[model samples]
Target chain A: MKQLVRVALLDSDSDVRFGRKMIISSNPKFEIVFESDGLSEDLVAVADGLIDVLVINQRLASGAGVSFYQSLRSLVGIKQATACVLTSAFDQPTLLLAALEEGVSQVVSLEQGPEALMNAIAAAKTGDQALSLGELYSLVLAETPSRELNQDLLRLVGDLPQKLESNLRRLQSVWKKGDAAELENFELKSLTGLVDKLPVKTASELVIRLQRSGLLDGE
Target chain B: MIRWIQRKNWIPEILLATFVFVVFGALDFATQGLLALLCSLVMSASLLFIRRFSFLTSALVLIFSTMQVSFSLLPVFALIGLLLVAFATGSFSQKPWREVNYVASVFGGLAFAADLAFNPTLDLAIFGGTIELTEAGRALTFVIFGLLAISMITLMWIFGQLLISRLLTVGSDIDRLAYEKQQLALSIQLAEQSKRFEIAGEINESVVQRISSVITNAEGGLYAAKASPEAAVRALEKTLSSAKYAHADLRRLFDMINLGEMVSSAPPSLEDLDSLTIAMRETGLDVSVSYFGARFALDQSAELAIYRIIFEALLNAKRHNPKGTKATIEISWLENGFQVLVKDNGVEVERKSALGANGMPLPYDVEDDIDSLLEKVTGPGITAMRERAESFGGSLEVQRAVGVGFTVSATFPVEAIRAAQDTSA
Candidate 1:
């Protein structure tokens, strides 16, 4: 018999906490040992030497998700715990970058459902990269291309213009409506991530052009 | 001590007169008999009251001179008495120079004629010994001596008049310079006061509004935390951000006040509109921004004015509007200028009085009209916005209708904006 993974959840939303609790309970391999609505002086007392995995809401009541994780990393007991960020639908890309820089092991979107959350948790426990395929692609797209492109590499990704046009139109509509809430659901990072998976040369050239034209960051 | 001397001007003149009187009395007592000595003492003593009773002293001196006409060298002493008469008359009278010259000529001529007629043969004194003069020669000598004495008196009178005129001119110039200095000081004071008022208006419009929004967001966060922890957390994040922004604004204002540089160093441009929209949205207001035409750079002051105008309009809309109200900002870059329009779907409310933060009555009157209501609610904010726009040769308009929402639009001329840009650059 394998030892059950001890997990701790910190979220300001009670519903999100309850949902995460139910999902972890369903899997016999994991057990929730501690939970909190926000980080406080008392949380330091409760979190001592108990949690194997720490799950936190990206938007905390007092500080940001990255900052909270940084604080937790300094604590003696939870320093070695696998850190994961539970994000909302409209989380900013800058915040995602911050979380990654803070050594967060996984980022699980609430809209991604319980299965994706479970997969991310399991992957985090096993010491493997827990980001989804699309998230990995976005990280790649966000990087600056180092070299120039050639025609032979471009040919590997067929019908590039059609896909680029489709994505551009979708982004334009979102910008025109000025509906920030709807923009969060559009998954712009995923579209760019798709482009980044093309042949290396083509992906590099395309990303450079998008960045130069200010289309990538939606300026 | 010098001021006292100036105030009692007659004291110095009296002391000088007494000194001259004593010297003349001793010379007369040694040279002449007791009668002449008595006449000299009487005339010299009268010099004490020369300044106080100048006319009486002149009369007494003339009487003493006439009584000593029989004396051999008494005519010379009589000439001294005639000079004293001129001095006393000139000092006592306003236009005494003409009278003094007439008196000196007549007295001098008569004294010389009396000396020639009464003692012409008696005088035998010369350079080393005695010399006798004929009657005709004595008469000619007396006439020449009288003419020379009159000329000397006239010259002295002319010099005294010049000294008085120069002193009067210097006094007038000092007065004019003092007046100019006072005027310059007053103008500088007024300019400083105006600058202080301008700074106050700027802080009231920008910093105060930001602080108020922070307070509102913090309260919202507190209430939301009780029901939905997630909502509370989001509200708290907003409150924190707003508070930081407000703090930065206050720091900037203080720096401007302390440094005497009222213009913003890093004023917000059109690129910053997105962040402002995001901030407003976080405060639970539905904010939308739209831009038309190609983007162009603007003068720092013009850009700051546009940003402030938009900020004030949005703040007013958010503060005065009902809950869930929607606001929109549209910016159009025209060929000759730029236009900004801010509109809100909120009902306009009537206000009973226009009062400032301290409950002091403001410049506007209370009314049910939208203009009065805006003036009452916004206080100095709207006035400051309008002033800023007009300062850059721009225009701002506020519109309100029965069913339509309140709207504010500002138009800025390209020429003025570019001119400001050139100056700053």
Candidate 2:
């Protein structure tokens, strides 16, 4: 008989845990050694050398995967563990990209159902570089602002026209949205990310609009 | 010395008195001659009391006093008599020359011109005098002196008025500038308050939607679970998942709302949104995901932006098509940074070009049909998605078909993301 694969799973969802357990229980080639809702200090200790294949959710009940991986890296070093991020939000490529950059061993999306997840795990045991939409999400998540702010900013910008027209509209929109809070929070750090990419006139118009909007009154 | 000089009009007064005394003394010398000596003495005494009179009244007094000087400069002092009349019967502040310097200058100029033009020979036919003058000389002196007098008086009056007008204008301009600054400050304050209201309104809308969705989903699960034990177990499981998200949602809403002294808690990453998708799917939407690219974690704002954009797109798709319609959501990081494409296939239905995201027309008037209701919902939704993208030094694009669907593409500069990470870390 082929050697049964030992798997370690980490995620916040009990349903997902149950579902994966059920899917793997049907297969004799896999066995679950450890399961957790999040990366606890105790789990991180055990995760360093004991686990062969680790599957973590993008989010844990206690903390995020990025922070978890960062902490894990310090404790166990990158060479010790082979980790995978199993996520449901494969619709966001940034999430997958982010995970891939983190050096996770495998990435899978629940959107593809249990069959794909099983295949991902089988591949991971063989040392195949298997990654999914979770990695893309990670990539996007790693680059943009907080997802909420990204959405708001994107909505504001997307309303604008494109190329030169887009930039012109962008300026008009930003100029319109300029308020006191925006100015106070408008850090110089994001200038290149947000304003610099806009047309000079449009960027200026946004600043002017915000200024005119009286958003900076108290400041 | 300056005060005394200011108080006295010695030159014109003394000269007139002396002229009168000399003419009368000459007449008296030819006639009685004794009266001329008395007139000279009286004129000298009056000059000593010159300070007691207003300049204009005093000038008139000197003119009268000098008439007697030719008769006799008497010791009783007609000048003293004129000084008593002025002190008892005149207002010094109301004296014309005391306030009107320009008037004084003009009158002085006129008097000097009259003296220069005076010719005894021209006047000899009317009254015989010792002086003589040719007709041409008399005409020349009169014309030249008259012109000089008029020019000097007109120039002095005009210059004085202009100086006063300029000072008045400067004061008023300063006052106007100060008023304008106050108005500007007030307008700025009003704008800030209005902006706060707008933000609060938007946050309220978001919260309402989130809370509503969560409640509705939870209620549905609870009801379904009550109907069937096994099914209830499944429903309970789903509710548990939604509960976590609902809690997270509430927390986020609180962070942004600023109800009190609250810190902006760190929000979820793009990675955390995987659970969001899973939770929302439990509420009854078929959300699909596909990806291609190297992986990287993004700033929290970027991830949230993309998540909300996709969430909105999904919500819009579901709202538009209820009966067994499939929505395709694609997220890819290509040669650019990242791209999001959400397309749905529903039954043939007509959508307006002017509708807003709420399915109403844009409240404000806009010309382009390219930004019609459906277009903005589809297009500007991505535009908003791009705002967060640009905040991370990324870009976004929204492309839509008439009846087909919409595609939203976003790209970020790798360098920008790295820089943000460096700072945030």
Candidate 3:
């Protein structure tokens, strides 16, 4: 007889936790030792002592899956427990890399259903890394090109701060004068052009921040 | 044709001369005065060149007419010559009122003296009788007539000055209004273009970027699920969560883009800093926030601008810095103003090289000025930050020194914030 793998489920959604609990119960080889809709002080305190595998949502109400996983690594008994991250379509490559760097052994997408969850637990029990094929392919495609591009971007924008300082000062003076017309007329094309040269991911992040701030597009 | 008419002084002057000649010559002919008609024709003809040599023409016409015409007919010649002198003085005089008054006074005095010396019983129409007066009475009468003539000339000169000044003022006002209208049109066009660019940038940053992220994560999950049965559940879970987030993000994007709904109900303020810090930390960034000095309220726009400046700085630090890099945000409220400083302890990436170590050429040259280069690479984020700060009469600074972490600081005058509070109250 095979040893049942002790499993702990952590998610912010009660329905998701209930559904996952039902799916894990079908597999006799997996034993649900602990489950919670959220990560609490109590859960973190007891999770290492009782569970062989920690299945957590990548996004928790309390914090990120990557950060939570990093915190778990410092806990007593969970140091050796397999940490599996569950992500959604909203996760970016940057997030995936962050989770992977934090020593998360398995990345599972909920869209893959019950079988995928079972497989991740099995792989975790054996101390083997389990990755979705899509993630592997994306990593392969994104890693090399992005690194090279990022390096190039880092070098290209090296003197950006010095260049923008004077204009910033001028803008400050104009603002102090309360001249809305001049502020509206002030040109930002050169700045936009420089940012366009950066890698897509980095540029997109900055651009999104600008959009949120009502900077990129006029309010 | 209109410009030519405006520029040529001779055309109007010649036309006036012709009208005067026809009127005066016809009158002389009807009276059977041949010499008088010839004198009228010659005087009118000379008036055409009055603008060219106004003083010379006036003196010559007066002297010649005084000698050739009878004393009674001399008044008619003197009238024609005075008309020419007034017209020339009006056109040529820089100080028209002064010049016309001086010339008119002299002409009136000379006419009185000439009548008194040449014709004793000068049928003084104004006095109503040809009184053979004593020498004292004749001198007094000459003085009375000269004074009346000077008073009449002064009145006409004053009226002419008022009319000319009024016309000039109207013409200048019309020109100014036209220039203002043109400037208004240009500014409107520029504002429209700016609005379009802003919309495009927003879509690119929020909608497009979020969709792309969704697609990438979906593909990653699908491939992972298909590769190994053991990894299927984990991959599927991620795909589901990502899909859900994508749906929510898309709905938000649509609301903003299609319905023009505002994403934030109220503009974020300093009180919202804790949430912003938490959000960054959720992205696996090590974010810390500290406040120093007294906390005070700011107006909506100023608060929003300050919030955005700090938000962008923190986001930039989180995106560029390595995982676990510590980002610290400090808010210092001084006596007269407030300052926000965001600092990150991350890798000090060199930002000046245009070429790679292997001699690979870059899109931009190494020699490009820092301003243009930074503008190109950082895009509108920094520019927008500076603009927001400036919009509220504040200042923002970014520092990136070799071997040192990146720092962004923004300072705002407290008066603006306080003024906002006063208005709200």
Q: Using lDDT as the measure, which candidate wins?
A: 1
Instruction: Give the local distance difference test score of model 2.
Output: 0.49
- Report the Cα lDDT for residue B229, model 3: 55
**Stretches > 4 Å off in candidate 2:** A13-28, A43-45, A48-50, A86-91, A109-114, A131-219, B1-425
How many clashing residue pairs, candidate 1?
0
Candidate DockQ values, in order, are: 0.02, 0.02, 0.02
Task: Report the poorest 10 consecutive residues by lDDT, candidate 2 chain A.
Answer: A199-208
For model 3, what is the error of residue B346's alpha carbon versus the real structure, in angstroms, after optimal superposition? 59
| Fraction of real interface contacts that model 3 preserves | 0.00
TM-score of chain A of 1: 0.57
User: Tens digit of lDDT per residue, candidate 3, span B27-60?
Assistant: 7656536766776666666566554655545554
Model 2, B170-245: lDDT tens digits are 5565555546534433443344345445555665544443333334334434444444456546545655665566
Q: Highest TM-score, which number? A: 3
Which 10-residue window of candidate 3 chain A scores lowest in summed lDDT?
A199-208
> Rank by TM-score, descending?
3, 2, 1
What is the Cα-based lDDT of residue B181 in candidate 1? 39
Could you tell me how far off, in angstroms, the CA of residue B56 lies in candidate 1 after the best superposition?
0.7
